[model samples]
Target: MKPTLKPLAEQVIVITGASSGIGLATACAAAEAGARVLLIAREDKDLRPIVAEIVASGGTADAFAADVGDAARLRAAAAHAVQRFGRIDTWINGAGVAIYAALRETPAEEHEQLFRTNYFGTVHGCLAAIPHLERGGALITIGSIAGDMPSPLMGAYAASKHAIKAYVEALRMELGEAGLPISVTLVKPSGIDTPIAQHAANHEPGEAQIPPPVYDPKLVAQAILHCATHVKREITVGGAGRAQALFAAHFPALFEVLAPKAAASFIDPARPQPRPDNLFASVRTGRIRSGEHHARRTSFYTTAAEYPGTTAVIGVGLAAGLGALIASRHRTRH
Candidate 1:
């Protein structure tokens, strides 16, 4: 039998990387929805303020400081959550790091670090949370459009995301074959107004800037909350992100031609280069949303992603209409 997920209010949601970015946003949203939230990250200082803010807002929240890359530490964190909340209903693996540098310029250690935190951290979280997630639990991980379409300067980061995509799919199939009551979801977001650019290990000549058409991090948080209550295979955050992924999948040669130009356009020549690298350590003190790159506040793709069935139906209808138009045009020409 298939799984039926619990509502957000009744859930004990665990969010990794909850100190900032998408994870922090997700923690606040889950807490607001009345779920008991557990925030895990490497920095204890960072988690404390966020938890205090959540509690002050009349939300139930706790903090666990641990390196997501460490399997033992994640297992301990999971145990702590179960002890505190009674059970785990949803586990979100949102802990990850990015580096802005060409593959050749990137150090071997940097590539290893990215994979350890981004890919292996997710792997550890899943392994630790799976046994404890009593029936009807959800596993959600944050991936990137870069996974589908490799970014020029973010080769290592993209490769880690690609690895995440592979394993998440494999894990989904395994769960189905076993007939478990669990929902697995992967969220691929394009550029967001996250401090990732400022935090990333920049080996490039200039400072890093988020790719064009950035959306608010709350959009991503909304998507994550949706997955907690709904069953979905995957959801891309923005329309631009979805389009880039489709283009990468269907038109590889064309993507190769345009991807570099897109990357070049993303770089701001005015900003000074070589900022402090957060590759191995945390740089920011405590912040939720990174207002680094100002862009649109809403994303149509994010709103649509919550309703997959409606999106599919609309896609099919549009395709059919186009086909009818082509047929009529050919008939008229003949």
Candidate 2:
């Protein structure tokens, strides 16, 4: 069994992108763990319910509507967190957008849009909240396994997450060097049991061929709440997640050899971009509708009991991994 993550009494957590998925789960988990939560996401309608849920359940929560990538809004959010609660104990950067297309095939604006949200969002969040960080405060951001290993169909999205990993690692070092009271931890999770990929944006509307590897968002959220209480170098969710992270870190050749298969099993090329009916440029919700993906009953790769999810595919990854090893040896000899 994984080590149990403990309670955080009276501390405050500010989670960006709290309206759905992991952010939403984290907010609930943190509040359940006895911490005050300030939820930030683009939509107030979505953010409000969670706050209301917490408040209704006798947990303290406040919802703030903002684009985490916006400097002014993030700065304001930091202040709001401080005002709402005495100190900023944990700040989570969770709101992200995925723009997955072949490099040359992707539009410039689309490319910029990813970086603006995934990378800049975290930067803005950190910038705003760091000033008010307490002695044991934590700065957490979600990075993908795609960020660590090269993902073909997800180049743009992966690059943005890759940049996030770089940013947090460097920030950790710099803060440690300066002896700041703040502690920063990065989370690299695999495919989650959420609507993230389903809601992924693409050039057209349809399913695309993807890769095999996957991990659950609920599991990642569980791991995230764990990190908030216990600051460590990194906490990767799921079993294959840690292995993949290891492959990317120590064996580039192994990771390279595995990339195509990885993409095939994991990347859903058939998944279409958010060509929404509205003009507001909202992110696609894919299979999971916004305000509809409830986390109370969510779990990794599958819901608590609805249907078998990603875990059902574990055997496939093992087979692919073995195949990748054989392919690697053959290439080395050639």
Candidate 3:
């Protein structure tokens, strides 16, 4: 059985890690589109203001404070969303943390905590959302390009994302075999211009920075919202990220030769001191975009991927036109 999702205006959406970054962006966008949104994060103090702002803008929204790592807390959050909004049409698992260090350099406790939030958090979100969405709905989890490619300094973080990808894929298969009406999607984004780097635990020489070719967080939010209504199996937000993954997959030796230098570039030597991070706890900032890096607003590759049929027709037309132009030039030369 395939899930039939409702339009954004008529749906109730629950977003974990909603206090900031991609989660906050998605919640605000959903509410603006008229979905009843329940925002979940670890800090009520951080969530309340965003809720108030959304409410002031005449969007239906509420705040729920809970750690995604805690299963009971996630269950409670799900119950609260149902109690407040009646039914959940979509659930987005976007809560995650990062660590910037070699795997050997990272503490065992930190590695465990990172997995608890990044991996188990998605698990908890899926378990909590399935009951509400069995009738029909979307289950979206925010993954990263690192989930597919190797990340050097962020080994633990990459490992967590890889685990998430595996788990989400297995869960999708199990749910499909069970004949449940649910659309499960994993959204893999490249280095997005969010506060993730600022919130990441840094064990390196300087502050952690999202590698180059950073994309806007709003693009990720747009993808998430689109999946709320569309039944996409997986969506990679940035084309460059997709290309990197493909290159790594096809040319493992070359990628391995260049990966360490590429990874070391993530550390900014200009910033000698490490910044405050949210590895163990929540940072109280609600700003969406990280102002440190300039992010591209549009991604033609993403647009083409999202609407492949249209792009395919356009590509054919362009190819034919170019061929005619080249033939004309050859005739003139002759």
Candidate 4:
């Protein structure tokens, strides 16, 4: 039988990369929804303020600093959350890193680091959280559209996401074969307005920006919160992302021609080259939002992803209405 997930109010949610971006957004949303939140990140200084803010706002939250890339440390964080809250209802593996440069320019060690954090980190989180999760618990990982489609500058990050997608699929199948009552959801967001670009290690000239049609991080947060209680196989966040995935699925050759054009425009040629990077170490303090470069508007992709039946119904209704109008016009002409 399928698992029946508990609502956020009754959940004890442990989130990695909770100090910033989508992870931070989800942490706050879960806390606001009455979940006991355990926020983990590499820096305590970053996690402390966010936790304090949530608690000050009458939410239950605590910070545990750890690098998700470190298996033992991440496992310890999971154990601490279980110890503090009794049990963990959901584990969100949201920690990841990105690199913006040509594949040739990127060093072997940087690629290794990307996989270490993005892939191995997720593996660790899953292993640590599984034993403590009762029936109906969830494991949500934040993947990227890059996992589905190729892009130019973020080759390593994309590769890591692809690995994550495969790993999650395998884990999901294993859990089902074992008849364990748990849900695994992979959330693939398009370009999201997060501080990730600021934190990424860049080899390119100008700053690295998320590809166009960026969706708000809150949209991603909403999806994460939904998956905490509901079972969704996977959901892509932005319209552009969904479009690329579909296009790539049906027309790979055409996408290959178009994708690089899209990628090339991501960086401004006029922008100063040789900018600062954050790959080897933490250069900036963690924050909830990034710069104002990304779009402030939400995407219809969120609605379509979260509520497919409703979207289909709406599509059908519009088609019927258009058909009726055409019929009326024909009658008038007659």
lDDT of 3 by residue, 224-329 (tens): 9988898988999999999999999999999999999998778887785335578888874797987887898889888887778899999999999999999999
After superposition, candidate 2 runs with Cα above 4 Å error: 1-7, 208-213, 248-258, 266-334
Off by over 4 Å in 1: 273-275, 309-334
Please provide TM-scores, in order, for all candidate models, with all chains considered together: 0.91, 0.77, 0.96, 0.93
Best by lDDT: 3
lDDT of 4: 0.86
Alpha carbon lDDT of residue 218, candidate 4? 89
Shift in Å, residue 153, candidate 3: 0.4
Pick the winner on TM-score between candidates 3 and 4: 3
Could you tell me how far off, in angstroms, the CA of residue 19 lies in candidate 1 after the best superposition? 0.7
Worst 10 residues of 2 by lDDT: 298-307
Query: How far off is residue 19 in model 2, in Å?
Result: 0.9
Which has the greatest TM-score?
3
Each candidate: RMSD: 4.0, 10.0, 1.5, 2.0
Please, what are the lDDT tens digits per residue for candidate 2 over residues 7-61? 5775788999787667887888788878899999887777676788888888899
Q: lDDT of each model, Cα atoms only?
A: 0.87, 0.70, 0.93, 0.86
Task: State in Å the error of residue 233, model 1.
Answer: 0.5
